[model samples]
Target: MGELIAVYLTVHTPRYCTYETAFAGKLAHPDFRAVRDGLVEQGRQLAGVQPDAIVINSCHLVATFPTVVDGTPRHRGILTAQEAPELIHGVEYDFPGDYELASAIIDRGRAAGHVCTLAADVHYPLDYGTVMPLVCYLDRTQRIPVVPVSVTLANDLEECFTWGQYVVRAVRERRRRAAFVASGSVSHKLVRGPERWPSPEDQELDHRFARMLADGEYEKLWAWLPEYAETVEAEMGGRHLAMMLGAILESGRRFAAALHAYGPSSGSGNYVISLS
Candidate 1:
């Protein structure tokens, strides 16, 4: 049997790292629009893979309690615009991969540190973190089922790691092949806070982080957290990235990350990582 391939990632507002002003002012940047367009394009390519599934793993869709909604396990679902209205309100959203992946992540999350719960009917719109990328990448006509695994609020590292193992194992055990996607962004300081300035050492730190992810060194990735938070923007996706990477490697597959872009367009740290 061929090894299972998963694409784990995160998603954020296009200018997530750049937000440092009032909502209106922050929304005024042309670069934000361009980056937003670029992210969606990335998703389009992901959808093209036509794998057994595409999972959207993120903390944005979390409930008060952690939950995993397996759309396909119970029923077939779609990623139509209306289904993920958070991306574009009032539009029915549907995708083929969303629900299947959601179910898997839910089961994985429960094993990792969670209790399953549904979104309380069909009205629970997917947050933009999911909608934006899925909608952007997927053609309106080509449906991909989606499964959303919402992270928990607890800070238990062991729970997170265990969940990572479950995610990796679940995908590996599937009789069919699949590709997973983690939908999140790197450090984002777009929101205003006293700690919202770009550090001089951001580029150097970004390089180190990108390299660690490329090398598949989970221990090294976790080890850098304390120093990274102090030296660079504190908003980087260390935990999110770590768990996703751990999940992928747990399945015994090596990964290579392409540093698509690692420059400071926004004041906060920003970069795009593609793992293969």
Candidate 2:
């Protein structure tokens, strides 16, 4: 049977060396450096697990109402992120796409009355949110196949969780060893400073949420997500977090979650964490 070996939560930024050499400079912020190191460690642990495929859901790839799944067998592109063209432009990405796994997720979601769709076009683009993590967490040597999913902003938190449930069912059915990566930020209340933390109110909520995650308080975390998302301006309405939460917690598995590192990005809160 297939198994999910680990769940990793990370923040993607165009300023990272792997993503943008031009803008890459010393990570002066202690917490930001720690986050970088933590991500490297997570990638190392993931490599050791030798997962059959990596399933990622990116906040930048938000869909209207359906969860978009990449069904293309091969993904090759030169990404110039419209959002941050100066930092992340003309970055080449060529990797194997998990067609079989993507198909399974789509089938299972539809069967379960969830909204999911497939993208098979070879020319489909990769967003910075998806590309940044791939380059940072993986290298040319790994060559691991990936299945990318998109955020559905129109859906409620419960629906996102249901989408995750379908993913679990599909993974088990296909007997694929998989790793899940949720790439986004917390307390995404943009301000002037790139290194500035969110406002005091949002910072408090973000820390509370982080505490709950690290403590493995899934029940309380789920109960608090709606309020947290609404109050804190969580990135992409906290859709990415909800889906990741569903994938791990809905599996009925207990994880000893570790907060590897956390930092601030343009007034938002970010972290590199592993649920293992």
Candidate 3:
């Protein structure tokens, strides 16, 4: 059976890509630069583990079904994020895709009553939420293959968790070393300006949620997630986080969770964390 080597939660703000220029003036802000730098280090550490594949659930890849797995054997793209083209435009990326593993995920998810399907078209492009983290975390060559999964807007948090369980099973049955990544932010209630921060109430909610993850209070976090997502407008409806948690907890393995850094992006709380 394949082993899940690690799990990570990362932010996908285009600002992360242009921190040196777009955010250069705001570099002095607490946790802004630190979070970015910490994610780089964490990416290096993940690369050192030499995983066979990295299964990523990107908030940007939204689906109406319960799940969708990218089964394309090869991925090549030049991404210019629509949300903030000025920050991340004309970025080229080419990487190997784990079609075998992705297919397994789809089969297993379907068997588990999820609406899972393979997206095999070469025309399918990688979203910024997927590419941004790969750019920050992987080597310039991107030696490891990736299996990108989409977050379903129609699914509730519990359904996302169930899909995650199926994903864990698919990975283990394939018998490859893999890592799971959740790419999104928290308290994603947008304000008028890009530099704005979320309200104090929303910030506090993010703080508490981060603490729960760091403390390994998975049960509590899972219990509170539904209400919290509705109240704080969590990114991708917190489906990405729910899936990450389900994969980790359902694996029946113990992981040490750490909060690497937390920052603000357009009034949203962006947190970087590692579960090893």
| Candidate 3 lDDT by residue in tens digits, 98-149 | 9988998889877767777798878898898998788656444677888999
lDDT of 1: 0.52
Q: Write the per-residue lDDT of candidate 2 for residues 155-174, one digit (tens) a residue.
A: 88888877777777778888
Stretches of model 1 off by over 4 angstroms after superposition: 1-3, 8-10, 14-41, 44-48, 70-92, 97-113, 118-120, 138-142, 191-197, 226-237, 263-267
TM-score of 3: 0.92
lDDT of each: 0.52, 0.79, 0.82
- The Cα RMSD of model 3 versus the native structure comes to 2.3
Whose lDDT is greatest here? Answer: 3
**Which rank order by lDDT, best down to worst?**
3, 2, 1
List clashing residue pairs in candidate 2.
Answer: none
Model 3, runs deviating above 4 Å = 19-31
- For model 2 the local lDDT of residue 225 reads 92
Taking all chains together, the TM-score of candidate 1 against the true structure is 0.71
